[model samples]
Target: MMMVFCENSFLSYFPNGHIFQPSDASGVLLFIMTGKVLLNVFLLCVRRQNLHQSFMGYFCISLALLDLVLLVTMSFISHFQNFMLLGIRFTKYHTCLLAQITAFTYGILHYPVFFVAGLDYYFTFTQPLNSAAVCRRWLYTATVAFTWISALCYVLSLPGSAIGLDVNHYNSAYNCPFYISSQTYWFSLGMLMIMCLILILCWSEIVDTVQSVKVITYESETVLFFPYDPECSPRDCAKHLLARLLICFISTWVPFVLLQMLIVLLGAQIPAFIEMNVPWLYFVNSFLIAITYWMRRRHLKVTEETLEADPFVSWKFCLVPFRCQYIDKAQKSTSKIVMC
Candidate 1:
């Protein structure tokens, strides 16, 4: 009697995991749908910015796009095609397997993208990056092609018995995702370990780069290779390096890193509690990737207080609405001025 009164269903997400009755179905669908839409809009914004030419930006966007596909497929498509009723057991195991596999692949694969993103930032800060060019675009495109092909091959290679990723049966006519066999789980887990090692190496190098810069800043008088105007706010450039960077790595990847170790290394079952907490992971990834695009597309507006210090002005400023470019000179100077 007590069990009947409280929620008996095991909800997959936590902080709101208990589902007492069947009426909550609509709410769940709505939640999933909203996440799906945000993800897509974020990706579209990323694509328009052509940060696709930059390896880190491109990879992050790719990761977001892959997650968008996997989540939507899980939310809507998998639900429909994946598990039909067999009195209580679900059917269409193949679809569920494919969806689950793709989701896992995206989850595992984004590790490389994050590593690349961190590396790009580290390189930008520590080493000379070549000017962006047409050939660079081709390289990024080629790399994207290779990653997609490899991931696709991995997904299609799953065995038939692992078709439906069913961890357990659902009550009523339900469609839970399928589960790979223990052997395959270990295999997937191993891939995640390799991903972790790569991220750690990249992060280690980034730290070294930062420490080296710190040493040079205080210990040596070497002029910065690319000088910044001392009068300008350091925050302007530093915002990209410090604040945005922390959000990209710590917020986006740290939860993922812990989960990778938990699920992959320990083979420990992640509490639905932790899994649900990271619901924002996809949203944040989309947001960060979208932010890079936003940064790229943004015009650097030099206000009155800051304009005097700009080393040079871009001619594009002439197109700004109602903005003025004026010349002021003393009467004597004006007479001496020559039009060239």
Candidate 2:
């Protein structure tokens, strides 16, 4: 009687208890719709030659698509399942498979893409000479395709079987439609750790590039390598933008990933309520990616345009938004001192 009562209490908060709350459902739908529109706008604005920018654009678009599909699947499943019927199962075998798979794919696929984005930023600064080749359309396309393919293959290969849902089994509730056995749990955690390490490495390289300055002097040749200001480095200017991106990624994923890790360590002893709602955190990434990237695009465009006008501009450094600082002196020292 106590177990049944506890289960009923938990279910009441969820949409009809088995799905999502009405407010949660509305928010998810809004996120999906807004993401689709913003991602399209982002893609249209991407320059053909910006390989890193192009890669990020395609990755976000894929995320938006995945979110849209997942939303549709959840809505469809909610409609088909009659939660009020006490004797009937709330989630069918096939329905559970579809929902879990869609959610899993959306969450797991981002690990590789994030590593790629971090690498993109790192390499774009480190290899100034190779900027043209780095931004090549073909390379961006290939990298995006490879990452998605690998993530899909890994998720499909995980060991799991569809088991009937039973409230009496706390572990069973955690596994639900498709059972995520220990092997699968560890494998997914391992993948996320690997990507996180790669991101750290990328950031390390970025810091190195920001601290070092290469001086080039030649007669009848002009070049601007980095900001003339001592206090500001390329990385410093970009840190806020990159920080927001990283924060969005961590906030959206850390909760769910941490829960998965805890489950692996503690077995079924982890709190049922924490485990049940954690996956929803993954969906938060979709909305965050959309808003963060949308906000980033305007600043990126201004930086790129400024860089284009100054061939002397160092590829390794971001253009600081201090052009206005030099505006008053432009006429007196325009030729001698180029805008940093």
Candidate 3:
């Protein structure tokens, strides 16, 4: 005799003849697929040397991988019957704990990745000359390490007493094996709020800079370059590139953050329709990232490539908005000294 628990229309079915319907697992499934696609794109980027080519690309790859780790681990626990059975029954405590830690760590890392990326763009646009220090390889490596270490330390410090399996405890609920503490809940929400604030500030400055630039065509190219004022071209292009990056970041995260905050603060149950959709929203960053790269590739195809001598190869990619083909020539001119 299977006992089914119904929470609204969502049901859960247990192996022990205790069946309940919870919200559909489609959201988690969607996340899994999104992660897979993102991973493929990430691998492609690696093969194409895109990730190694720019600091921004490296950060993007790190973010994508972290996102995939979180989604795949969460999905595995949700869909693998044996794993779910063990987790729900508390049969394998250590294994379950490891999974919990892995998921939480990856989820927490999301905020720091955004925090660093936002800072990178903010400084790269607002402080052009000084931004060179910010984009240094050592610094980028340190930032990535800091993100993972901080998240690990924070998760490890949470009280283990509050961590346990709550299997179908509610009349209408999914039997999630990992029970996080209220402290964890508050910490996660706080992180999201902080990240949102940082992005808002960063993008505001970027938009302001972009608006200040008087865009004009140079040599038949709709370049942001101020040919008469060569000093301004690099900065203009920086602003334009950062503006697009900001848009991509915000579009993919704001809705997901709002929904998460609502669910956390109000105890409002997610609507079935939304529950099936929000998980995909979380992974939309990956798609936007790929689209950003594809757009760049398309732009390259449309425009003829011009080679120039620059001490830094990454600078070429960094000046993504303006074709920057003649930037070095402009920099060498007596009128201005432009250094990227």
Worst 10-residue lDDT window for candidate 1 reads 1-10
**Model 3 lDDT tens row, 150-246:** 8778755554323444443332333323222233244446656755654565565455544544333333222234222224465554444545444
lDDT of 2 at 152: 58
Model 2: ten consecutive residues of lowest lDDT: 270-279
**Estimated TM-score per prediction?**
0.37, 0.38, 0.37
lDDT (10s digit) by residue, model 1, range 23-88: 333334335545655754554453323222345445545655655555565455445653445533
* CA displacement after TM-score superposition, residue 18 of candidate 1 (Å): 20
Query: How many Å off is the CA of 14 in candidate 2?
Result: 25
TM-score, candidate 3, is 0.37
| Candidate 2 lDDT tens digits, 226-333 | 323435566554543343334334433566557556756665431111221212222322323333343444444334532332122222233343343443343334
**Whole-model lDDT per candidate:** 0.37, 0.40, 0.41
Error of 3 at 326 (Å): 7.9
- On TM-score, the stronger of 2 and 3 is 2
